[model samples]
Target chain A: MTSQTKAEQTGAAGWTRRRFIITLGAASAAAAGLTALPGGAAWSAEDAKTVEEEIKRLMGGKELADGAKIISMDLPQIAENGNTVPLEVSVESPMTEADHVTTVHIVADGNPRPGVASFHFSPLSGRAQASTRMRLAKTQNVIAIAEMSDGKAYMTKAEVKVTIGGCGG
Target chain B: MAKPKPRIRAPKKASKGEVIEIKTLISHPMESGQRKDRKTGEIIPRKIINAFTCTYNGQEVFKADFHPAISANPYMSFFVKVKESGEFEFTWVDDDGTTYSKKSKLTVN
Candidate 1:
């Protein structure tokens, strides 16, 4: 009788409880195996959106943190070389034992992964600072995000002007 | 690939409210493993500066993970606000577990 009720609940989603359990087992099996299917041949604007969703899902599906006061991004007004354009991000946070910046992610809009890199931090980090030179295929906005220990999120971004093609188009 | 010579350049000293800039560069080819060798006809293995970390007096100042997409001789510069004089150590790690490191001392003025 109890199993019948569980089956009824699963039936709402058009899945039998027993079938659902089997599907879960198969998913775990797939997760442990080298079963990644090759995706599309090329990246498009839709791919960019999907990548954004994937990264956000990696972050627990939280909305992007974007604001002006807490986070800031610095980039060259005009990139002399798309191969190595300087980028920096800093958060105005007092890195203390009780409060500190947790992580920062640099994502270029047009890149394949978009999420180029991420930095995890602790109170040991005296201040919130990170800088790196990045490769941009074309003019695009570089997004910088920061998560704080206090459960607050902040973001900043800047557009880079890419003049020459670096990928040898 | 050759062992990269890393540069660890930092300020001589720092005081409260002073922002100390740190500069670093490593001689690396930063191959993305996507291209084939001109002669060998085999794909050049992807090797890159995967991670960079900085610690101040046993505390971390900043850290970053790089990708093959980064340019050769990755040059990075960032500033840290000085609260007290301490030692700053920088470490760079490549994809093959090879680690290159350098350190400098900061004296509070």
Candidate 2:
């Protein structure tokens, strides 16, 4: 028997199998839409926190110094692919027990989430240098802040032009 | 999702007080929860390795807190000063409470 006839024969309370399937699909779709609406709103709320705010949150009102001389950030001037952009950050420090880098926080300005990664280093690290790969949502400035164990912080930023966004754009 | 495989590169032997580079990479999707399915238009939930740590002989050497901005197949390289002969333990923690670890021994001259 044809599926249409089967569905008609199986009808109960004026609800055909075809109508039930369609209603089920619609209900799921509505449920998905409902979930996505709140999720998207939450993401935007997160994105509203700019890079500066993020840095301030991380620094906890500490004074941020210009790190042009001490912190070296190596990134591409223009990223052809935002999926994987190479980044290298090194801070000039003695790596001694008395003076060393405690953490290096990375933030991107234009991404949905500004917080990227934070690298914590100890004296055993020998050097406050690290390299990693990150995703860029668009053309924006990537900032690096190095917090020293001596209650000092250094900040530096670099701009990267991206041809294509990586955050599922 | 497939199981994430952790990979590490470290020198088996090093001179005392010598600074050595350690590289680590792990296979993961790093879903940012920002993407939507093309057909279903449903949002994909985020799942990523949120933390990585390296310890030498029970001493913390290096650690990193990751976010969704980290790309797929997370890769990181850092420096460590080898003071004594000991084993290095590396751990990667996922968002789902899964932890992947690897150990390597380094002999310091």
Compute the lDDT of residue B34 as modeled in candidate 1: 35
TM-score value, chain A, candidate 2 = 0.73
A1-169 per-residue lDDT for model 2 (tens digits)? 4445565545666643342233443354344322122234243234335676787778777889999899999999999998899999999999999999999999998886788999999999999999999998778899999999999899999999988777763
User: Residues A76-144, candidate 1, lDDT per residue (tens digit)?
Assistant: 888877778877777877877688888887777755345566776665556677777777656777877
Q: Can you tell me the CAPRI class of model 1?
A: incorrect
Quote each prediction's TM-score.
0.71, 0.84
Which candidate tops TM-score?
A: 2
TM-score of chain B of each: 0.92, 0.98
Residue B92's lDDT within candidate 1 is 92
Superposed model 2: Cα runs more than 4 Å off: A1-48
Q: What's the chain B TM-score of candidate 1?
A: 0.92
Per-candidate DockQ values are 0.20, 0.49
Give candidates' CA RMSD values in order: 12.7, 10.0
**lDDT winner:** 2
